[model samples]
Every structure is written in structure tokens, then in C-alpha cells.
Target: MGRKYLTLASALLLALCLNACGSRPGTVPPPSGGGEGEGSPLLTPASPDDCYWTAVRHESYNPSFDRTEVSTMPTEKWWADLYLNEDGTALFREVLGFGYASYLINVEWWLGADNVLRLTGEDYDGELVTMDGRMEKDRSVMLETPYGDRFYFEPAQKPDSGGALCIADLEGTWRMTGGEPGAGEKHMASLLNIERRWSDGEEGGYILRAEYYSARLLDTDTPQYETQKELLVEKREEALSDGFSGEPWSARLFSEESGAEYLAALTERNTLHLRRSDAPDGPQTVYTRSDSFLPETLTLTLADEPDDALIFYWRDPPAEVAQPLEALPMTALEKGGQNRILLVGRWYETDIQFCTGSAEQNADGTLGEWITDTVLYEGTLGIDEPQWFSLSIPEKNARLCLFMKRPWDESWFTWPITDQDPFLVSGNTFLTET
Candidate 1:
């Protein structure tokens, strides 16, 4: 009986070993070339002294939804290629499509360890391409600038979404309203309402888009306009979510009577005009200059007196702060009359590198930690608007940090600039106990 039990235990041990030896289905064994599995080539660790070269190409395509024929490059595949590529001394580029394929485009290039070259242009098929073998570097790659130099080919984490630079150019508030003129009336109220949406590229330029909302009246006390108003409201809400089916601009424009190209041209800023479809002698009207609705710019301010208070600034101030309130260092203020508190340093969230996986392994790839959703007005004040934050000061002595928030991002993060003293106020100055 003892021998029989021993035999059973041995058999179980053998079975277990065999199961361990068997390969699981769908699991690819590490590749022979030395990379562990088919992991992204871009993430392969670099040699100690060697600088790597690679890039994430963000190709923007503003394609319409219904048009099934239109195609776009997947973001994950492009990102994978950047990490999986075997060679580092090469230019990496990617192109992607967004929206209804009507609005924006972006192109990014990496020049080795520290140099990065970017170019942007509009039009779906605009003439834009950059390729030259001479630009390649077989040895070390570096870019020299007046202030300092950077290793162009090195890898630094970037944000998840793709966005345009010079978003700051889109600065300013645009009171946008939509509608066409009646037969006798020169202008009509906009059917769509506008909401502000700020997009920060990486961590720098901030751009705001006033999302237009179209509303039709529901049942109301006004009998004559009730039915039509309800339908209009339904249509406007549809426009907000689904947008214009084939061509968003048509539904977005003044009237269906307008030409397609004409409406397309209006997409450019301050160039819209009311013109007839045919005869040259037809009466015409133009909407330009101040007549055009534009975006508004929020104001920014910093601290007063002793400069040690300013350490960092972040875009998208934290929600914890009550806007227009100052962040003061409590203990520092009580001692030596040194109210070492910082305020009013305008900061914008550019990017975040979220480290994930087991902290023990440290091998798990860094997920995209950067955000491009909203521009934050960060400092040490609890001001709702950045402009208001700058204009107000704290009544007491306390050290606080402020930040803005956006809809697209998950949690708040700070930029390197914000981590450093960007707004430190001290000395006998105007910003004193008052």
C-alpha cells in the first residue's frame, strides 16, 4: 500500500512537470533576435553611451464618418513601430486621421538625441513631405542652439493625443453664433451654442475651440414657434454629437443654398462672406474683421516682493484650490516677516509619463502619461479664471499650489517648470499682510 501511494505521487509530479514544459496557445516565445517577445522596438533599452533615434509620427486626418472608403492609420500600431524598430539611426514618421477628415494635420520628426523638427499644414492632400538620406546620422546626433544643446535622438515621453502647435495663435474668446440671414434681415441668431474647449499641445501652446451647439425649441408657451423650435432643438443636439453627416461644414455653414467650396473656404478665420451662387452682379455681403466672432484670452499674473516664492507653474489648476485664492507657506510667513509664498505664475500641462506595471519588475512599459485635452492656469492661487488668479492676492501668509482641470484628462500632473520655483515672493513689497 505504501509503494502504491508513492507511485501515485511520482506520477502526479511527472504530470505537473510535463504541463509546465508545454507551451501555451497564442503565446509567442521570445524572439531569437534578443528582444523579449514581440514587444515594441522603440522601447528597447539603449546602450549605456549610445544615443537612440526614433519618433512618433502623428498624422491628423479630418475624415467624415459616413464615408466608409476613407481610412486612417491606427495610433497603437504607429506607436508600436516606434518602439519595435531595430535601428535607431532612422527617421520615424506617422500619419493619422481625426474628426470627419476635414480640419487638421500634423507631422513630427526627430533629429537624434535632442533635436526635434516639426512641420504642419492644412488641406487633406496638401503638398507636404520631407525625406533626405543626408539628414541621417550614422554617428552621434546633436543639435546646437544659442542657449544650450540637446541630444536629438534620445527618447522622452510625449502625450497620448495628437495636437497642433501655435494653439496659442487660436488664443482669444470667440463669441460664435450660427445662422443664415432671412430674406429681408441681414443677420440671424446662430442656431448652435458655443462652449470653450482648450487643447494644450504636449505642455506648451494652448488652443481653445468653441464647440458649437445647435438647439431647436421644444414645447414652449410661445404657440407659433413651438413645433419648429422643438425640431430645431433636436437637430442642433444631433449636430453637436453626430455633427454634419458627410460634410460637417455644410450643416455647420449658414445655409444649404451655399456652395460646398465656398463653405470650405469659410473654415479659415475671418474670411467668411455672403455671396450668390451665380451671377456676378448679384448683391453680396461680407463678414470680416471685428464683425467675425473670435476666441477670448484669459489673463495671467505672478507674485510680488521676495522672488523665492515662485517655484513652478502648471496648466489646469488643481480642483482643490478655490480660485482667485493665494497659496501661502504658513510657517515661513510667521517667521522673520518673510511671507515666502508664490502666486500668479501661468503654467500649462504639456505631458506626463505614467509608469505602470509592477514596481518590482520596472520592466513594464511606460504608458502614455501626457495629456493634450485642456490648458491649465497653474500657480499658488485658488482663482477660477487664470486672469482672476493673477489679479487677486492672498489676505494671509500661506504657501499653496494651484492648477486647472480639463474634461479629457484623468488626474492632474505638473510640468517640470512648475516643479521649480516659478513664483516666489519675499522682501518688503506690496504683497504683504493686508
Candidate 2:
């Protein structure tokens, strides 16, 4: 039941190579009329007793290099899951992917006593593709297309009971929450709605619609836009093999638009965990079951005026011109029990300076000298993205200064500086007053 990863680019390359080689001898083709073929003693039809099987395919590429020569090398593998039912119906799930864009293709299959395996399925584009393969040693299935494309699959270990819950328990709407903390203001202000509807069938099929908004400016309280995607899913016990802990039942969701696969596990807390099959380390969002499917709007506003002590000055890279910006209030910090200043904004590598003493003002309204100035924090705001930061303040009413660095200039050491100036140079900075 362990999850397998594959790359799409490699899979495409393999398909191209197979097409160029031409069909091989001894490969079976599906009969024009669906029925039994001439029996083969050595390759009899797979018995219904051993109906469940898992298939896998793997591909890797490594370049061979020498002092004066270089060459490209490639390796390919194939796998699948074959399920034969007592009612004469068969199901075949083919795993495919490259990197984070991995998915499974479900196809209806049939095994002929003549050692031919017939597979018919609708691809992502809703086009039908039929193929046939010859069985080998009754333990392995080798499928091939008329274009000479071949895929091999061996028996896979059985999966454990996924959980106590069934697909019926997940047939409802859910509100999503709990992602990367301090990620950004937009992330904090956004909300997600997920609706699961079951289909009228014995296959325990369902459709999931995920609707989410991407807020451009958190301070404005308006979302930049909203996106909704539908995914097809089926209760899958094999999901337990991927080390998911929750109510035992699990499901696989396939997005036809992106051709990506996601594993969903419902926990006892009424939360559903979603993870992409290929990008295990990627962000995982938890969705809590909700009572209704109605969507909610999110609005953010400051509770009170920011204290003068909380004022900060920001300057873009090259540290040339200084701009004063107010921070957006965070509900988490407004509770007031914690002695930390939470700065939640989208920022690059930024330097923060705090003044231990109060700042004096001149007659012209310009700021005077600071009694004690110290760098409180200095580093990148987030990992690959702008995230929030919580800095412990020594005392209340301390002045804060911020300096954001622009992205590195790739052509700094080159001839012409082609790339546009870093985004931070726009003289805009995020800060909160409260």
C-alpha cells in the first residue's frame, strides 16, 4: 500500500519511445467481440480467488559524464492495481506521475482464458483508449497497446483497514482551516469551503468541490479572486498504507484539470487532511466538517489606533529612501495576554530595528534622535514565501524600524542589469497599528 511517485515528463518520453519501436510479436489484441478466447494451459485466466492486485511503474534519468564526453541515460518501470470481482467485472488502476503532478487512471478490464488482458478506460480528456496485454506465469500482467507501448505489473501486498468511518460519513460540507501559520495576511484572511456529494452507485463514488479565495490585499478586506475545482473520488482502503492516521477510511481525489491526485483522510476530530501524492512535503490543509454549505465572507479591520510606540520606518534595498507604514492589526495579538509583537505581512529578507527608549520630536514635526536603537530581528520572512513573524518585545511603547531587502540582482556581476528592480523598491511596506 505504500505510495509510489512518478514523473510525467519521463512517462511522456517513454510513450514516445514505445511508439517508435513498433509492435512486438506474441502480443495479444482485444477480440472484436467481447468473449472468451482459445484457452492456454500455461496462461489461464486469473482466478477470482486472487482478485486483488497492485501495479507499479518507476522511471529515472541520470546523465553519464566524462572529461570530454556526456551522454543521457534513462530507466523505466510500470505498476498497477488489478481487482477482479465475483460478478465478472474487473477494475484496473494505473499510477502515473512525475514529481508533484501524480495521479491514477481507473479503467475497466477483462481477462481472457487465452492469456489476453483487455483494458478500456476514459482518459483525463474523456477519450476512450483500449489496450491488451498477455498474462505471464499467472502472477504478472503485461499490457501493450497497438503502438507497441507495454506496461508491466506485479501483485502488490494487501492494504489494511483504513479507518472506522465510511464514505457516507464524509458526504457533507466542510470548512477548511489550519495551514502554514504566520504565512501572510492574505492566507490568514482567506477561507475555504469544501462540499462532498455521493453518486448513486455501488462503487462508493463521490465528487468534491473545493472553493477558495485568494486575497490580494488583506487590509482592504476584499479577495483578489476565487477559484473552484471539482475532483472525482472513491473510497480506497489502500490509502492506509501511506501512513495516514485517522478514522480508518480514506479516499483518492483526482483533479482532471491539473491531472493531480490527492489523498484524503478523515480524522476523529471531524477534520479531513488532504495531501498531494507526489508532494509529500508540500502544504497540507485540514478541513473541519461544517453544518451548512453556505460560503462566508471575511473582513479584517483594526480594533484601535496603533500606539505611537508601535510606529516603524521601512526602506527598500540599497537602504536609500525611508517610508512610514502602519501594520495591520492581528486578532491573535489583540487578545492582549501575550507579550509579543506579531508582524504579519508579506515581506522579503527584512531587517527590524527597535528603539528601547522613546523618540524625541523637533518643532518641525520631524523625528529626533533615538536614545537606544538596536536591531531586533534580521532574516528572510518566510520559506519560499512571505510569512508572519512574532518578536518578543522587551517593554511596551518601543519604537520599531524596518528595512526590507530587494531580491538579489542576478546580473549584478554581469554586463547589463536586465531584471527589473526588486518589488520592495515600490516604497510600500506593511505594518499594523493597535
Q: Give the candidate number with the greatest lDDT.
A: 2
Candidate 2 per-residue lDDT, tens place, 1-434, comes to 22222333333333332222221222534345543332232432343345456544422233464232322211222224555444434454432111111112345555444545676765433467777775564457666543444455665554544322345445455555566533454443233344544445443334455444323344443323333346666567554334566756667766677776766667753777766667766766676765443222100111222432221222221211100011222222112322223332232333333323444555774444445455444444431122222332323233443343334622111100011222121322334321
Query: Where does model 2 exceed 4 Å of error?
Result: 1-30, 33-39, 42-49, 55-80, 85-106, 145-147, 162-434
Q: Least accurate stretch of 10 residues (summed lDDT) in model 2?
A: 411-420
List ranges where model 1 is wrong by over 4 Å: 1-134, 137-180, 184-434
TM-score of each: 0.20, 0.31
Model 1's lDDT to the true fold? 0.25
Best prediction by TM-score: 2
lDDT of each: 0.25, 0.41
Lowest lDDT sum, 10 consecutive residues, model 1, at 226-235
What TM-score would candidate 2 get against the native?
Answer: 0.31
